[model samples]
Target: MPSVNPPRGMRDLLPADKARRERVLATIRERYRAHGFDEIETPVMEDYVRLHAGIGGDNEKLSFSVLKRGLDAEAIAAAADDPARLADLGLRYDLTVPLARFYASHRAELPTVFRSIQIAPVWRAERPQKGRYRQFVQCDIDIIGDPSARAEAELLAATLDAVDALGLEGAVVRINDRRLLDWMLGHFGFSADERPGVLITIDKLDKIGVDGVVAELRERGVTPTAVDAFDAFLHRPQTLELRAFGEGSIRKALPEDAPDDVVADLVALGDAVGRARGIPAPYFTLPVQFDPFLVRGMGYYTGTIFELAHPSVDYSLGGGGRYDGMIGRFLGQDVPAVGFSIGFERIVDLLDAEADAAAEAIVLVHDRDLPPADLVSLKAALVAQGTRVRLEQRTKNLKALLERAAADGYTSFATVTAGQTAADLEVKPLS
Candidate 1:
């Protein structure tokens, strides 16, 4: 027989594992609910066209594709070399793209401004690193059809609360705007068409250092002057906090197309997020700050872009931004949207590191020959009194039973005595 093991990048969640995750998940859902985001669920598989509609960016290559069936099967087989043509459906890589398609398909039935909560597993066909996996859950909360900066402010504030709930200190969300980024690129001599590709390169700054980025940019044919100016900006020493960068020396270099009012907008956004009330009043330490070079990997972001990064690890705990033009791409009508997604797996890893693994459990050892009705009644009574119960058949060997319960994370045990009824139950601690 083959070994009973999960796939390379997946694993089973035991009972205690589930408890810890559920605890964190409950906190996140409560935060989302308090922010007025209603829950929504989309399918695991979406049409292959949805992945290629230009929203996924680098993620499209990582899609787990499903082959064609029914009507398209013949054409797919005829053109076997091109795998994309042979696939009609693919598993979703992220929730945002599918959400856009969902809204387009079911707009009439939804509210004018749809605030959605989608917590589900997404698949990718990429290399599995420390926190990256082939299958992982992503928690998304989006406010669609709202064009104001308040949407960004509220999303950041709510995410800060979620991060705080996860017990992460000094978790700050870095803020920037794609519009301002473009103006900066244009200021440094990049043409209209070069900005998008350049922004993608900029997004890789954290992964590849400035030298690596410059090398890649030069390989992509970026001019030397543009690269030099970008390098200078990256290496310049300055505090990333709002007050520091809000009045830094770099603030004086705004081009004609890039309005200087962006600073005012940043100040207002920071204030709005700071003022926005959370269930836990001060949800963040250094809440929202500025990262002039921060560009999220997704191509759909159009306006404000923000990311919440892990202090120890070089990955975002969560991130989201305005994708105003994405829905319009699907519906043929412009609809503004802003959203945020908490990286569920990353947070889970953080929690797991601190998890004790031996959370409280109670095991009920009943007689081997006990009637099923008696066991059921006893368990129900215990549960009704707000007790956690796990029933097992009582064997002659006391040591075996105790060892089994301990291995299963049970810290206490209970049993029925004397008469065969559940009412004559006794409880005792395992330790």
Candidate 2:
């Protein structure tokens, strides 16, 4: 007989894992709702063109394409041979893309400066690893149509609040603007075309050290002086300070008539949000800075771009930014937008570690000894009382069941003992 197992990059979320994920998700949803964001749903599969629009560089490579098996064989074959054609339809790589398509298609139906929360699984074709998977959930919140810095500031505040509400410790939101990065590169002599490669290399700065970034830049044909100048700018103390545009030389170099106006607007917005919400104050300590080198590689971002990072982890928990131009790519008219995504798998990994340290468990006792009605009642009671319960099947022995549950990371267990009745059940916490 073949062993039953989930597909690679996916898993059977045991009860305890489900409980933790639910808890985190509930907290996030609650936070989003409290802030007046409506809930919206989009199809899991989208026309490849819509999904791939405005998504280029590294993210484009990770998209998972889908096709009809029999009905469109010829079309599928043609699409498979051409990247652009393949993107005419595919499973959504992230919620943001679908949301952009949604806004553009249904702008009349949505409110101006519409706020929405979308929590769903997004597909990717990347190789799986620790805390990284090809299929995973993403929690996203976005505001469309409002260009005020207040929206940006409020989103940052809400993100921090949501993470803290999940009871996770040491999560930090690192923010920078794409305009700042663009300005920095230009200031250091990187041409407009060179900016993309430089952005990709610099985005990895935290992963790879300064020398590694410099080396990669050199390999990409950037001058030695440009790399050194860029490095010095990023490391300066002013980079951490929320100085007004007039106070900085880099700020002066920014386009006099940039439409997004990230420098003055986003920084002030971050400051206002910081003053209003003290909880995320430390996380949003400095106003959104202009880090000319903070180029987020996604082609759609037209304004601010920020990332949430776990203080101890090298990878981002998730990130997003304003993409006023994304909707226009699909609808042929500009639609203002900003949003952020939470990396569900990374968050689950962090929560799992915390759960392990706390030694939380749910034990399932064999049901053979108890009458079926009694077992059902007991299970209902435990669940109703906010306890995660597992009911063991009759075929499993007590010792085997307990061992298996323990290995699966359950810190507590509730079993239906032979002598206990449904009306008078005794629930004990496992040591």
Candidate 3:
């Protein structure tokens, strides 16, 4: 016999560990439901074409393709050289894309402005790290068909409520609008063609510092004068505040033909999220502030994008924003959508949860010589008294069994022998 191990990046959660994780998920799910979001579940696998669509950003490369099964030798040889012909489906890398596909395929059954709650595992083929895994859970709530900034506000409010329920301290949500980046780049002399590529590079600011960004920009053929000017404005102390959001470089960079209401939209959103932090709940003090440097990597983000982070953790706890156009690609008509996903795996990793000691109590049937009916009666009795009980197989090594069961969280054990009444049974404390 060989040892059995889970695949890389996948993990087996023991009973205790699984219970703790489930508790965290349950809290969020309940909160989402209270906000009137309906729960949803999608398949683990999706059409390869949908999975490979360009909206997922770098996640496209991380999808695990499913091979064509049951092919004859001649057919396999004919298609083996072309990836498109080799695989028809792939494991979903995230829930958002699948949600879009679901809405597209089932629009008639859903309300116009659908508020949905989905908590499920998504797969990605990547190198596993301390907290990041190839397969992990994502807890998402989204609103579709409401194209107002109010949609963004509600999503932020509900998300903060869920986060408050999580009770994690010192977490902040840093936000920026995609339009904000576009306006900034247009001011810095980047051509419309060059802006996307430039923003993609700029998205690495947290990973690679200013110097690295400048070098990468230069490598991408952006002129020194433009880079220097952009760097000077971006690095200044006052940039963080963006002061009245219309001052200094941001003011000067504003294109003459720019939409006049962009500033107003920013102000409205800021006030809304600021008020979100003030909502009544435990740990509601977690901050949500504007960050001009935030460039969420997802190409599908058409408007505001925000990243949640703990002051102590280096990686983001997950983020999302308005992808008003994503679902339209599937349905052939545009719909408004905004969402925020809590990194369920990372949250479970960072938080501590205790096991339920009462649930671990057991009934150890130490004597096979005892009638099976007596064992059942004892277990039923214990359960009737609101006690969880597992009957252990008889073993001569009572001390060893007790030690093992105690270590495994059994607090106490009751033993029965042949011809012994319930009163004659010996009840022993295991822990």
- Number of the top candidate by lDDT? 3
Question: Which pairs clash (backbone N, Cα, C closer than 3 Å) in model 3?
Answer: none
Q: What is the lDDT of candidate 1?
A: 0.78
After superposing candidate 2, which stretches have Cα over 4 Å from the reference?
A: 1-5, 54-56, 68-80, 83-88, 222-261, 279-292, 352-423
Which lDDT tens digits does candidate 2 get at residues 261-280?
A: 55567547655766756525
lDDT at residue 150 of model 3 (Cα atoms): 78
Report lDDT per candidate: 0.78, 0.71, 0.79
Cα RMSD, model 1: 3.6
Task: Tell how far residue 324 is off in model 2, in angstroms.
Answer: 0.8
Q: TM-score winner among the candidates?
A: 1
The local lDDT score (0 to 100) that residue 154 gets in candidate 3 is 81
Collision count for each candidate, in order: 0, 19, 0
Query: Can you write out model 1's per-residue Cα lDDT over 1-431, one digit (the tens) per residue?
Result: 98798887777987656766777788899988988889989999999988877789889998989977764656766878886678889999999999998999999999988899999999998687788889998999998988877777778877887777767777778888877787789888888888888888877888888889888988898777888887776666656442433434236434334556766677667667766643232323346667778888788888888887767777788888899999998889889998999998888777643443455467888777777877787778777877677888778897798887766567788775435444555667787
List the candidates' TM-scores in order: 0.87, 0.80, 0.84
Query: Candidate 3: deviation at residue 238, Å?
Result: 3.9
Better of 1 and 3 by TM-score: 1
